[model samples]
Target: MTKSISYRFALCICVLFSVANLSVADTLTVTWTGAIGELETTIMADTSADGTQAHAVYKLESNKTYLQRSTIVLESSCDIVGAAYGTGETPATIQPIPGDDGASQFAGWPAGNIKTYGEDQSYAFKNLLFNGVFADGSTTLFGVLATYGKGNTITVDHVTSVHNQVITYFCFGQEENWTLTNNTAVQYSCYPAGMYFGGFWWGGGGGWTGTVESLLIQNNTIEGAHGQAFVIYDNGLVNRTEGEVINVDHNTFVNIIDWPKFYRHGNNTRWTNNLFVNMAANGQTRNAANTNIALNNDHVGGHGKTATLYQGACTDSTLLADGNCWDRTNRNISYQNNAWMDTPELLDMFAMEPWCWDLPADSNGVVVTLCDTMIANQSKWAGDSTMSMFANGVYMSNNLHMSDRGWNLDPVYITAQTTRTRDWLDNGVHDTHTDHFWMHQADGDKITVEWPLPMDFSYLATSAAATHCTHGGPVGSTHHMDHPAGLTLNTNPDGIVASTFALKQNYPNPFNPSTEISFNLDEIADINLSIFNMLGQKVRTLTNGTKPAGVHTLEWDGRDEMGQRVSTGIYLYTLSNGSKTITKKMALMK
Candidate 1:
């Protein structure tokens, strides 16, 4: 009996030790450290029915890519909350710190703060790069919250999400409805909107009437988004009991189609200190109660100043747009203390006065160089590879080489050294890296066209003797061409390949009898080059067969499919392979 009791006591001690070890093991930790790409993490509650804590950390080295198609997903029914950590506001100020590239730089949410509230969480991402995304692609790359509980807080700060074509970074309200006042989104990169607040249309759900309160969006740089920076709409549903109090401030937006627009919203929607450049259309359209729009500044780039303010039909009288710096007029809305400082063309286009008829008139507003306001720092003027700086001039370098120090239309290549330039003596040949030429629209037209230089003639041919000349055939030859690798025919002994596919503007555009339509193919493919009249009727078929890729030219004799010359008018020439198609317009002066 004594021996048996001793054995039982020993077994009890072993059981207790195992239980203690299991308790400590319940704490979960997930970590990912590597180059930029897709990442995922899943955490579940301990099986003991006791709420255990789980922690996750992600670290990236550096990335210069965009539209990465990377994803960080966190799916759980347990408690999940997170805070972004790092500082990456100015690239020059920060010396590209090792181990952290993207997580810390943005325009929104306070820098370093951690507050947790949320039940059954999804993902939190930081320090990443993306190339581009599409609408039909995996829309949810980050997180999809399936359940909602009270006092649940989700925080996303100090994260840079850039160059997504259409997919939103984060999505809420899919399976069950939940109210969240502790959720925060800030400091993102280029997304359709920094954040989208609505129900998933394809998820077979009705509208989301969940309350999202005290959400803060600030201090992020966004550009190249095709839709509004932020949108909260439920199929235009009226009074369905969804509440939201959003604060959008201190963000930089460029090349945006629309600003933050709210069709169905709650109270206390405020937008301030947000800088918008190269806006394609309207700024803000908030038709909500207690809506305060103030101190928002904007500039329309080369695209026309069609930005509008259409609050004229708001039923809520509390909607006030005051102390903003946009094109404000009484044409469609009631506004005050707003200012307008557009170009003479914009001034004539709008035909509205500078000052709005509201209290605290906009006396401090004035027009300045649009580029100056964009760079934020004058020292970062030319060398900054991140943002494009627009200019209009031609200057000579220290070597007496003429250079076009003006806008390079391609935003992807912004560094001063990489920008395209034309030397005065090059006969029309441009540098290898340059994509556009700074030229007057016409012989006397002062406005520069930044016309895309011909790919075949654009690059400089450098021989071993350091002699530089145009790469293509004799300067005036129409077939000066380079074939993309697979597009070249086996007959060419030199085995040269084309690097890019392009359709050049037809030369001698107003030719009476015939004109040359030129294009370069990068790869061999079945092609269909056809001409269509302004009325969308196929007037002539240029080529509809397999063609070896190189720079090829076809003579359109200004004739129709019936082999008869058509009347003088405008026509569109379309170039289509099996996968891609492009169109260009031309005029025939018969």
Candidate 2:
């Protein structure tokens, strides 16, 4: 049936509504009549003094590309095929203010700018950017910003901080629930980050209580930053927080002179599955040794491919390096398929610098290091409850490449976890994907994870070697369809298409009860998914990984940060790979 003009226009409007009000979908048009500032402010106004909000909306004509500067700044999830920048003053550098109160302005700054907020407010944006542009106003405007608080949910999504400098976008808070996935950060720097988290006033010592638990950063492409890519624990912020499960997976890093600085005393935070290509891609003409890749600058991955973390230390922490594909995975692991859950391969034992001392520098010749000390053993350290792979300090397991090296972040400290493992094959004749099933209890107590073995993904790395993958093809080829002989879009070219992303809607949305939200991947890349209330506050994160694509899910019962079921209302589910995006709406019927 031929559609009428009004009906056609309504369909067009619906296509325009990404995450926000769907009603506007039928009336909006993508025209530039020089109206940018007010629209951008509308998005900014969504923020709160309490710091408990985050949002992303990929509103675009499915056929059209390119995002406007105003839309990029105002909207959370968008694809700008062209150039985009934000209005506002370029942020001046902000040093650790000695006496900034959590509720008031940043130390020594004017009023109205809340220096400290809750973790619940910082909803990490996970969006994809393809052939696009981004502009952040000053280091303070926020590409990523986290504020840990009594609120329990850290949100990080596929958001690329690019081509703008002022205030950084990432921050941290008291209770950590950080998840940064598949976002690209390029040619942007100032303040403390091209990509960063300015939270917890962590320069002096680890402050606050409770482990910054369940945080993951994966599958991101970052380049060119003025300050450190990561910053943790101020000198005064240190407070013994243990069992923090931090994961860095399947991401690529380049042109970042200064990497993340660490407190070195905390038992939380894990780094793995990420590869740094040009460790010295920024500045290394006279400083060759400095050019090498070093987590704390103790060693280098070198030009071709070799990187080191933890200043060449071999101690048992929560870190396992597998995403690098080669650098960190070179360590010895004895267990089979234990690819990414192993310790790092340090460069030189004696030459290893202490972690705090070997930080990277910004474009300006500034040496940055984290200094808060005098932490009490009980600070932030939880006695129990950590949902991670290596739940303990360090252990060894047989692996695909080498013998295992580090301890597992076990959710429970018992001898073993009630776990399940499944294998997917690419056989053109008899490939099995959904058939492999096991017993599941539906109880949310145990951590459930699904992975693709090295042999499973070998097709991408070894198509010529028939013995590698069951139904294999060359790298970047379509060899992963259900039938090995069939060629399909394994993942989209932009990485944002529905085919490229394994997205799922929040289950039991608008329910007085809860439901399960799930997704499946076809390959290994960083992933991020979040649940947001209609007002744009991030409520929870389901999963983030640099894991091989298969299937995955997380349960979000109808509840708020306080563990109370929220009022009956509308909500949205967002997923991204920093290149593509998909969103679904669910309801919570009180």
Global lDDT of each model?
0.31, 0.31
Candidate 1: 10-residue stretch with minimal lDDT:
90-99
lDDT by residue for model 2 (355-393), tens: 233347878878765321111211111111111112233
Kindly report which residue stretches of model 2 are placed more than 4 angstroms away from their true locations once superposed: 1-33, 43-149, 166-169, 190-211, 234-244, 260-267, 280-551, 554-590
The digit string of per-residue lDDT tens for model 1 on 341-442 reads 111221222222212222233467643221111111211111121111112111111111112212112333211211121121112223343221221122
| lDDT over C-alpha atoms for residue 241 of model 1 | 17
Model 1 compared with the native: what TM-score?
0.32
Top TM-score model: 2
Output the lDDT of residue 579, model 2: 60
How does each model score on TM-score?
A: 0.32, 0.38
